[model samples]
Target chain A: MSGKSLDNRRVQKFHWMSRFLSGWAIFRQSFLGKIGLTLLALFALMALCSFIPPLVDPMYQPMAGVDPEISTVTGPSTRHWLGTDFMGRDLLSQLLAGARVAFMVGVSAAFMSVFLGTAIGMIAGYMGKFADTLLMRLADIIMVMPALVVLLMLAALFGQLSIWFIVFFIALFRWPGVSRVIRAQTLSLKHRPFIEAARVAGASHLRIIFRHITPNVLPLSFLYMTFQVTSAIIIEAALAFLGFGDPRTISWGMMLQWVWKTGHMFNAPYWLLPPGICISLITLSFYMLGRAMDEVLDPRLRKEGQTD
Target chain B: MGNGKQTILELDRIVKRYRTKGFFFGAHGQDVIALNEVFIKILRGEIFGLVGESGSGKTTAGRLIVRLEQPDQGKIYLDGRDITGLKGKASKDYSRRVQMIFQDPYQSLNPLLSVFDTISEPLIIHKIGNAEAREDSVWQAMKSVGLSPPHDFAHRYPHQLSGGQRQRVAIAHAMVLKPEFVVADEPTSMLDASMSAQIFNILLEMRRRLKVTFLFITHSLAAARYLCDRIAVMYKGNLMEIGPAEEVLRNPKHPYTQALMDALPKFVHSGGVKRYETLLQAEREVSGYVGCPFFVRCKVARAPKCSREKPPLKKLDDSHSVACFYAEPGIKTRSGGKA
Candidate 1:
């Protein structure tokens, strides 16, 4: 009994150690897929800024001044590098404070879009018939309308739309394209032998879809989610730049909007350029990362790479 | 014929029709009868071979037997139970009893999963054991299929395996559930000649070991002759003949079966004499048609009767049955065009 217990402990240790090693290897390999790694790092940093209080204290707000016209880069030497705006608030702190908001909107929108799109696509492809017809037609109708225009109109009417509301709107518009892709993939996968095997194995319809079908398509969904986040961030930035963002909360886009309105283009390029550069870099990184993930995750592409 | 064994599966007057439309607008839609009143009985522990060419509805019949596709009109009985429209738990139970092995081995196993996980999936779904026991069962299954050492194979992915190894994995996956009846639909078709033989041997071994009944569907008559005890010839969704494998292969009464036998490349003969004559004979016979399905390709086809009226299945001997109008007693020496 003692020997068996020791063996069990050894096996458990081996399993966990292997898992850690594999995870480390994956992390290492991700660095080779440079674009994805950079974006992932940025996203991680953004997440970190949200939970870490000192990283994003309200005292570091850059643009919190009584006279809005006065532009000065002056703050605490060690903590606030970008200095204070018109309100003598630290720019670094405000930027850090806004990280959580950006991540919340981006990730929430992506999750909603992916969930709804994948479910709809799987249902349409697997069940087919009238359900497919109706859903696809609805998707088409939604796709025809200009998404940005609708979002702008909605935001204007709502007047300082909540983060969740913005996420909902973004997701509602974003799902159509992903739905089509996922539907096509699901349609092909439905006819595969594994699905038939699942059927013959006495698996229920829901079980087959969730267990067999969903896992097969999950990597593709993940890749698409990354792309979705990049798009969501851009859209959120665009909305904020156009003055539809929450006035009370300062985001990267809000920073850009402030810079543009105050006509800082002549004197201080640094203030406007930092947020703009960050936005472009983050989006580009995500796109590159998504492409790399697509290549790696897809078995067909992986096989091709192996052969070559 | 008089053994009177209990039928484990039966397809009574099954019919499956598919509606097809043209690519262009306003093109007339037509109904293609994929299976027209097809009937067959599979006895318990019997390896019943369903042999046919492409589009013969053999795969469709196999699908119907497993309830993967519901037949338009039919009653399917499993172990004297009416499973025609069984749903939910009843259907699931039926599925567990009767499993199906698909044609392509490559597509049969999920590409993403490891060998152990793939084999253990059914056990997991059926709640056969806890995690530890399920893993043990998976390893046992892998070892049984000659994928040893089991530990080595369990960790390896699908792409790492060869075609034959992949096929073995697929078979292991199917057999892991210990199903009573298995429908191996052209399981060896995609395999190489040597690999095909290996798979056939493995299947035979599995049958002996597990005592599992198999409905082996194949287009290859040679394969059917080797593995199947009884063979059923299918022509355009119709069961033309069914009998002992040796009897069907050696003395084929159906013209389609005879033609198929003749089409097999003889080892001794070369290009000129035997080959051309066989080809010419096949073409001449296949050109003329009547009511019988094989009439279009029968060397010994009669005039009006063969074309006008469909031949019902008639028992020729104790073990053999042929669906030919002229399958009468002591009528073997009929005047023919070519021997």
Candidate 2:
């Protein structure tokens, strides 16, 4: 806190920061939010440490690094920590690298989908009548198709999908659900007096949609992004387990696939449980994050007697 | 035209109708006539009062003048230039000189916007000035609206302010551009008595300092009497009476106006608050009728004449007009002013 008065820009920034801090205060009280944040932090740390093992020892690399001494799957020991897989690759390093992939696939895909959905929804809602009907019907058409099945068909048609392509398709398939929620939010906001005030203030339609409507709907969009992250990660994991995932990437689903394919599904408990547990926990954490955010974004969801 | 003053805004036979959605597809429900051939002329620098009950189309009329909605069958002239169908640059230009202050202070200001952003919005939209100059304009507007020590309130959001403070911010938002005409639609309806008085005083100050013409739309007769130079009473999309505020409040001519005056609760000690008792206890069914809108509820209405025809505005004096079959030079009541 400076003694001198803050300038206009600083004041504007401070306003948003204060809003966020207050929201954080409310968010911190939710049990789900605390657990979700701690789990996410752990996964983030694991993702960050994924590069360290490969740097210290080449054999600890998740892919293309074989332990010269181990020829078959082994139980946990000082040598490999979690254990060595049938391919002589370290399961712990593979699990850490999988965390990195999960974060990448989840966040990038969720961000892209949310950005697309919010834009389309705001336009469809603000520019009602023809544009609204057309866009909503299109959203309906895309939403009904199962995303995973479509991705499998695409993978079959164009062999060996890249990791980035999977993220892109996940985004493409995932936007309609977000668009529906955002569109509904935008519809409720369209007739609010504030929007009318903006129009009466001589704002162009573009200005009203972007400047006025965007900020109002953005919190909802970001809340949906957390839920979208959960779905994107699950979809990617499913694709990798089904062997449609990018072959070059080391993901938890790919590790599960290796364990199942090598007939170690019953014998290798160490390799099997870690990747499966990691996948489920990461998705659960994101879902919990979304739930807490939903409570934060909508005040009506807060418990009775609570006051801002 | 009544006192040789310039008419800043005129609504010539404005009619606005909204069609309600029917139960089934392709079925059209009744047209809700929000405004029906309503005519008004607001003079430059005068506070014109538009008084009506709820659903009387007063707010709709305000929305029309501000171009929030277009009149179905009329021309709105700003300084004699027809602005009913203004589009593109012309419409944007029209908005620069015309503004509105909405009724609900809590709903009118965007919750996400801070005080500075809300007030400075008009300047930004119109591209009026650079950042520093815009800040100066916002500060000046805030000061004029009594949001002093600009730094203290500039960063505060709408939720942090009380009802009156929010209304002041709303007024500042409307006044920032120094618009020539403003339509304040029941701006103090949601505030407490003292806050309403504060808002009224701010409006008076704005008119005094800026010389901005106002069409003050409200349902409160006392508020209209306090702030308006001229007052027009509306009922069911029809204007019942239009006159100088004092003359109209003191000696109301129309039966509906008399009923409205009769409905005001009088103090026991107040001397001789006359009641005309012009309202019928049982409302007459008026489906598909073309008579005066108030004919169904008027106690003094006559059958075969008042029920058969729609009355046009008839002049009783230089500045007073009423739409009634049997309007007379109203009996003078001892004016015990302000309760």
Task: Compare the candidates by DockQ and give the number of the best one.
Answer: 2
Residue pairs clashing, model 2: none
Over 4 Å off, model 1 = A1-36, A39-59, A63-100, A263-267, A298-308, B22-28, B129-140, B269-290, B328-339
Candidate 2 chain B: worst 10 consecutive residues by lDDT? B330-339
lDDT of 2 by residue, B136-241 (tens): 8988999998899877898888999999999999999999999999999999999999999989999999999999999999999999999999999999888889
Tell me which residue pairs clash in candidate 1: A60-A90, A61-A89, A64-A87, A65-A86, A65-A87, B290-B307, B291-B307
Instruction: Write candidate 2's Cα lDDT for A1-308 as tens digits.
Output: 22222465677788788878878987888899989999999999999999999898999999988899997999999989999999799989999999999999999999999999998988888888999999999999999999999999999999989999999999998999888888999999989999999999999988888888898999999999999999999999999999888999999999988898899998989999999999999999999988888778789988876445
Please tell me which predicted candidate would have the highest lDDT against the true structure.
2
Give the per-residue Cα lDDT of candidate 1 at A26.
43
Q: Candidate 1 residues A33-68, lDDT tens each? A: 675676668766965664453434544333352224
Per-candidate fnat, comma-separated: 0.60, 0.75
